[model samples]
Target: MSKICEICGRKPHAGNQISHSAKKSTRWWHPNIQKVRVKLPDGRVKRMKICTRCLKAGKVQKAVS
Candidate 1:
């Protein structure tokens, strides 16, 4: 699967890691994602990949049915 959050569309960020010796290396920062079943507008449950921020912020509603 792609390294992207379906809810927030967050993707991996590329950057560099600096060492004490002044050496730099490529690095990537990926968002924390989780798959969950959420309630839709039509009252249907659907599985989607969401980020931790959204989950913690109560942006996603869990499907009851």
Candidate 2:
């Protein structure tokens, strides 16, 4: 599966894991994405990969049929 959201353009982010001992380790943060259907401007439904934040934020208009 693709590690990117087609709708929100969300992708993996790089960061570090901090430990109590003041140690740091490399880590990756990926967006919460899902495969869903959404309505388009033409009133047609289509399947697309979108991030969960967008869904929760009501950025996506309609689900694909």
Candidate 3:
């Protein structure tokens, strides 16, 4: 699965992890991506990978039963 947010274009970011001994290691911070069915402008429901922030912010309408 692609780890990218379709709406916000969010993806994994590079960072570092520090240990108790102050040793740093490379790490990747992934966004909270979810597979959801979105209601498009033309009233079409399509599945997409969206981030939690976009979902919470109502950036796209969700397809509800």
Candidate 4:
């Protein structure tokens, strides 16, 4: 799946992993995204990749299982 959130547009962020020995390595920080059924304003439900943060914040209408 794509490493991008369809709701918030959150994507993988570039960062560094620092070791205890002062060594750094390139790494990617990705959001916790899940494929969920979302309800749209037009009363259409569609599957989309949404981050957990948006779910917690109630930014979009989630389809009932």
Q: Against the unseen true structure, what C-alpha lDDT does each candidate score?
A: 0.87, 0.84, 0.95, 0.92
Task: Say which prediction, candidate 2 or candidate 3, comes out ahead on lDDT.
Answer: 3
**Model 4, 12: alpha-carbon shift in Å?**
0.5
lDDT string for model 3 (6-52, tens) is: 99899999988999999999999999999999999999999999999
What pairs collide in candidate 3? none
Give model 2's TM-score versus the native structure. Answer: 0.80
How much is the lDDT of residue 62 in candidate 4?
91
What is the number of backbone collisions in each predicted candidate, taken in the order shown?
0, 3, 0, 0
- Looking at model 3, residue 30 earns an lDDT score of 92
> Which is the winner by TM-score between candidate 3 and candidate 4?
3
The C-alpha TM-scores of every prediction are 0.89, 0.80, 0.94, 0.92
Judge candidate 4 against the unseen true structure and give its global Cα lDDT, from 0 to 1: 0.92
Q: Candidate 1: worst 10 consecutive residues by lDDT?
A: 1-10
Instruction: Output the better candidate (1/3) by TM-score.
Output: 3
How many steric clashes does model 3 contain?
0
Q: How do the candidates rank by lDDT, highest first?
A: 3, 4, 1, 2
Name the TM-score of candidate 4: 0.92
> What's the lDDT for candidate 2?
0.84
Candidate 2: Cα lDDT at 64? 35
User: Can you rank all candidates by TM-score, best first?
Assistant: 3, 4, 1, 2
